[model samples]
Target: MPAAATVNSPRHAMSDTLNQPTSFSAIDFLRTKSLANVVQAEIERMIIDGEFQPNERVNENALSQRLGVSRGPIREACSALAAMGLIEIIPNRGFFIRALSSDESQDLSEARAGIFGCMAMMLAERVTVAQIAILRALLARMDEIVALGEVHTYYPVNLEFHKQIASMAGNNRLGSIYQSFVRELHIQRYRALSSPDVLHISNAEHREIVDAVEARDPVRALIAGRAHILNGIVRAKKAQQAGEATAQAKAAPRRTRRTAAAMEETAAGTPADAATKPRARRGGLSKTD
Candidate 1:
């Protein structure tokens, strides 16, 4: 098997967290090997599945009850998650799912692009025939999914395809970083690939990556890999803008029936004694009122 971090293995993720200083103590490290690790994985799964949405506070008491554990384990697991860039720990507050701003998301995508590009170059020069076959199979699977235009199904396969390449690159360090970035990008990636067209376009780039690797063209492989992620950043930005526009439209309330009628009355010139007319009682105005 490749030296990649398995789909949800905590060992590799813990190792990365242990190396980083997020106030994750030695005691917490040992806890991860024990009960806390299970809790961590469950919470990670929740985030991945969008059960626990971004910026939503994790109710520790609720988790403790749900997992049949005390708050201690829940807290420890959340601390570990914070280290993994999946949660944010606010002083005096609590843990929340990490929500990346557009700028921060762009920074992370650029970073991943650099590392993924480098790994693609490595794969081009040394990938074995078996690895190539695995990639081809994933590509075929993705093509099938795209034909049906099922992005929800295609997204995970797309992730697996890139992860397979990261593992086949033969560098554990790069693979670990790539995995962490992948974890961080999960929420935004769904937005970046909001439609079947995006999924189809993304896989086309994957074809370039595979072809370059097969031809042992390191330069072409690197370009293809970097371009894939950089283009994804553009998609992410577009997604962000679209979301913002939607939010703005929501925030600017629609003109109520009463307001519209008042505007019309003013436009047509109100009667001279309109002020003397008994004003209607103040009440909430419905859209159709």
Candidate 2:
């Protein structure tokens, strides 16, 4: 029988607060853990689902109040997110959610291409029969999701599929680092090029990658993966440019809207004399009776 697969366990850090044997210390530790979990889950969900919005400032005070946690925990959570590249920290200016940019997206895509290429090559060299079967099953499921048009369900599964393969490549450090960058990269790409059709295309490209890997062709898999990432980068860049153009185009209309609103308010606030012209009646201007 095949041996059970081993998974890495989460590492726990020693706490300085552990020295305090009082109930208050215990409660504080639990509270800190809860706060960190809540804040991390909320922020991650917002970023992945595009609810937080790009280039928006994260209001730490409001977030702390909403989460029912103190500002300290909120600050700690924001620091963690910033470390994960999910947010941009401007010194003395506070944390802002990172925006999708063409250049940045392209750079990430190129890096992903190189990393994923190396991973795929490694997997091709060392993947076991069981691993191959697992990959095939995942690819089948992915195809099923595509057939059913379940885009949302497919997205996370697809991410996990790639991440799992990267993990199986026998280098713990490489897999860990690759996994760390994957989610943020996906979120950025999706922000720039969010469309059902494009997602379907991506799935098809993934199919090609799986086929190459299953064939145990290292060069083929590497090339396919690199090409897929390169194409995605191109598409993301175009989408980012398009987004910027659309925003620029709307600027004029936005200004016009603001001007019209101001004029309406001014008209509403004006005295009657400013709004109505004085008229002469019977060759004389009328005055107070």
Candidate 3:
């Protein structure tokens, strides 16, 4: 019976072996050729995944140990990320994940709106039936995702939908510039979508953009696409203001208590109160005498 069991175990092991890849491909070797780029991509993924919060310091030593690489490649990766605007270097301190200020976020949104609006206009003039079909399919998928209240799941799809529009425009230089803008906008959009209400409003704007595109009206498409992105700016600003208001509300009571305690101390230590009490002069005589 034991021999039969061993024979069955060997058969199971063989079946598992058959399911596994026998060897790595050429692409695998190409990925390892640039250690800094590989490390940069991993760190960028961590930032996008919210593993590292905005302005949080990245621990070089800890990352090196975890990634099984030395500090040199890690430092190089940090510099690369900084160049890409994903992280910032603090001179003597270290690298920290970048967070855009409200004003900066607004500026980025406006810039993106102009570029994307142009792309939409261009696509409207030149888009084929197949391209329109692709955009419609993505819109349908986004609508389904939003209906199910899966806002988080819709972010990547939203990016891909815009990217497809940029690609369909068929301007390589414009596409390159648009890609950079989109990369920086990712974090800002994520913050805006923190409120579920924004999801419905945003997708509604997306539908308008698609309608304008399908109608082959360049001016209307430009307006729709640009308005959608500008509205994103407004939503991002509102979210920022809401966060600030909440933080201030939480700190208000603490500030009030501290102010009250300070006032009490000041009253107790007043010169008028001290003057009411008797005091010996320095020469062992009262001032009245």
Candidate 4:
């Protein structure tokens, strides 16, 4: 039988390939990032874009279908997001977008202020002329945006300005932590800086910070950075209060109308005009008397 036709045929050349060393490529590195990371990033974008409102439930099935992925990856992604403080998971209710309470938001702002202050101080000590030039260029761009009254476009440039400062600080860990804080405060910061006046004020603060850094005055840089973030917190609070007040003003008339309707229902069988008129006293003297 031709020696039973040796099993190691030319077509079955697995031994040679198996013995060879494996090599990695860009694709392998990309694959190492995991599907969950990709899903997490996309979900983060959705939250940042306000597609998912605070406290809104995350529909795993819907996201799975939308992203063309399996439910396992969606769950994994949600778990990662939860770890990042961007989502909350309930035992039986599933995951909901995390909403920071006012106190919590304030606390985060304070913490970020400290971190940013330190970053600014470090950058002031270590920043080079090239870095300062880059920052000035960004400021120029911001100035142009402000001149055009395009407040919306200023937000991204504002973020880039701060990020460049953090980068120039030469501390990767600090940059990573600062980035997390920025992500957490993304929506709130946008709301805070939405006003053109607030944007101008913030840009002025940025200029002060840049000036301090350029002068290599770490103490001044620290104070400027801290003040800028603290001012942002105040501005955000004021904006929130103003929004609430406006909403209440808009709703007051509707609520009053509702109450009036309920009163009318209670006084059924009375004339419509009588609802607004005070009832006459019983057994009182007539006007003729």
Per-residue C-alpha lDDT of model 2 across residues 54-95, encoded as one tens digit per residue: 778888888877878888877878888888888889998998
Candidate 1 TM-score versus the reference: 0.73
Candidates 1 and 3 compared: the better one by lDDT is 1
Clash number for every model? Answer: 0, 0, 0, 0
Q: lDDT per model, in order?
A: 0.87, 0.75, 0.84, 0.87
How do all models score by TM-score? 0.73, 0.70, 0.77, 0.76
Which parts of model 4 have CA positions greater than 4 angstroms off?
A: 1-32, 269-289
lDDT of 4 by residue, 183-217 (tens): 88877887787677777788899999999999999
User: What is candidate 4's CA lDDT for residue 204?
Assistant: 90
lDDT of 1 by residue, 71-187 (tens): 998999999989989899988899999999878888899999999999999999998899999999999999999899987788788889988999999999999999999989887
Task: Provide the global lDDT of candidate 2 against the true structure.
Answer: 0.75
**Cα error of candidate 4 at position 201, Å:** 1.1
lDDT of 3 by residue, 207-260 (tens): 888888889999999999899888887787788789889999999999999999
Off by over 4 Å in 1: 1-33, 65-68, 253-289
